[model samples]
Target: MTIRQRLNKQSICILMLILLMMIVTACKSDSENVEQGINDLEADSEQLNPSEEEEGPFIPEGKVQSPFNGKWIPKEAANKRPIALQINNSLAAYPQSGIAQADILYETLAEGNITRLMAVFHVYDSEKIGPIRSARHYFLDMAANHDAVYMHYGGSPQAYSYIQQTKAPNLDGLSWLDGIVCWRDPERRAIPRMLEHSVYTNQKHLEDGWERRELRKELKENFSSGLEFVKEGEEIIPWGQRADYVTVPFSASYTSSFDFDAETKKYVKYQSGNYHLDEEINEPLMFTNLILQRTKIHLIPGDTEGRREVAVIGSGTGYFISSGRAVAIEWQKSNHGTATEYIEKKSGKPIQLNPGKTYIGILPQNLEVSFQKKAINQ
Candidate 1:
């Protein structure tokens, strides 16, 4: 055979080997581990329910209601300062532990078309919170709404500028003064994840973080979120608008789908083709309240990293979703330090939630968000 033919045969063999390696790399998730997680979610399918909302909205004689979820608790815990943690969202940050405990989550585009999360916790009880990521300035704006002490690792220049200008209460896990609150998981690090993907925060971090930042634990007397809840025995049935399922187009790789079960009266969350679960609680992270807060988004001038600005504050169009339906609503944020208000466009009354865990989607206005009467393939 000619030398050219022999070289051609060798090149074909190399290309075939490379293609096989690519296929294996893409399918390398430990199947046994994934199957076990799916099994656990099935077993723990009963964690969240609308029956949790059965209590009267009226504050009992001595009990205080949480401003976020409207659950009754000691008055002392009622108004605790919220801690907003920035959790990473790359595929490497899989199984974000303890996120289901957050009272509210703010999701928006970070770098690329990908998204990031700022999870606010009033009770401060999540044991494994993150491979905690950097801060986004607009996320800080939401954190400021609750007077939350912002906790993050690193941050973009824009975020740091906002922190400096507002003198916002913040705890940086990467600061020489505060990195003590963050620890690298030995096993995770051993997995040889990118160093950024191995860091996590625990209860100890919470304790020290508060001490280092000199922040208070609870709210002052008479503080309120001004959030309304649906009256007992009432449902948020939209006026003939179907909303049994919604799919958010956050990115080509990452999006979230929620299914409302009439029997349970809770939204079962699915993301990236799996039921999103709290690995710690072994339960699907369900919500009685969900909002799609759509707003104008823009790219910062001359920015190469592709971080964009999200208009979360000020008046905008949005949707309040519950009970297998959605109502068009207007969301207003009066100023930097004030809480966001969701008002019914038709009745002009404040939108009331179902008094259980809530999910808020901070989506770009231009994205093609859609819903269905039936669910996407499970």
Candidate 2:
């Protein structure tokens, strides 16, 4: 062969070898890419749908579940009785302090067609709480049921009589501890806000009063809240009507409402045509559970100021609301010293609450409570 032809042949062979190398490299790279994509898909699937064997949230040692809300709390606070404070809920008492930390709150009718709030705190260390109000006789029964230390600015004649008869441990703002444990807030004492709604107190002050009075801080050995809660990872499918919005009317003048927040799965409170916000944090008051308890309530015969007498120690029909739904429930309080039992009407079992804060509204039987599947304004 000629030398030029031999050189051309050698060049052609080299070009063919180069093409073969490129093809092999491309095939290997495509295979590697496919393998990596499968691995990524598997990882994503594991994250989206966790295995049944996977564990839930980790709880630290020396922690115990709270009887009030079913949340984990420090072990030291497990046996400690909660504190029930009477908070003013009038229009002037807007933006009340430290109520967001309450594990459970109760609302009941007071004089003048207005409602009062009783906040029960199991684990709280806030700097301020209240706009403290006077205690009613029915509130004392609730406090006793929780074995909580009661704090109030003053009391009605019936309330004082009940306290004297039961010998319940309490700290009265009208007593000598007025300046020591409870005090008047300077801001609230200003004009436009009534002086009667200026009382305020903190956790430290309450603790001091409790220690001085030698009140029992720990719960009784056999005491129970009689509240059931769903387990972790469990969903509550209420077998009743949807309740995205709830309206609780105490009287023609005052009505309390709640709107369900889908993202947070909580019901945000509204009163006086505005959101009920906390003074300290300026955050809207929300609750995970709401219980509207219907019972007999009326004014005392021949009594002035329209003071109300609520019958709490008996069985009654009610509704338990949570997770944007509500279910009919029966509430029974056998006696003053025991916690109220709530049973589901459909299953005839104890009503189970979702883990978080709860609000119990003591409503009159004659009043009408309504709920809807969607927000009123939206």
Most accurate candidate by lDDT: 2
TM-score attained by model 2: 0.84
Q: Per-residue error at 220 for model 1, in Å?
A: 5.3
Displacement of the residue 132 alpha carbon in candidate 2, Å: 0.5
Clashes of 1: 1
Residue pair clashes in candidate 1: 79-219
C-alpha lDDT of candidate 1 relative to the true structure: 0.78
TM per prediction: 0.80, 0.84
lDDT (tens digit, per residue) of candidate 2 on 108-183: 8999889999999999999999989998999988887788889999899999999998887789988988887799
Clashing pairs in 2: none
In model 1, state the lDDT of residue 243: 82
Query: Candidate 1's residue-wise lDDT over 86-171, tens digit each?
Result: 98877767777888888787677788867787788876577788878988889877887677888888899999999998788888
**Model 1 regions more than 4 Å off:** 1-61, 177-179, 220-222, 231-240, 373-378
User: What lDDT does each candidate get?
Assistant: 0.78, 0.88
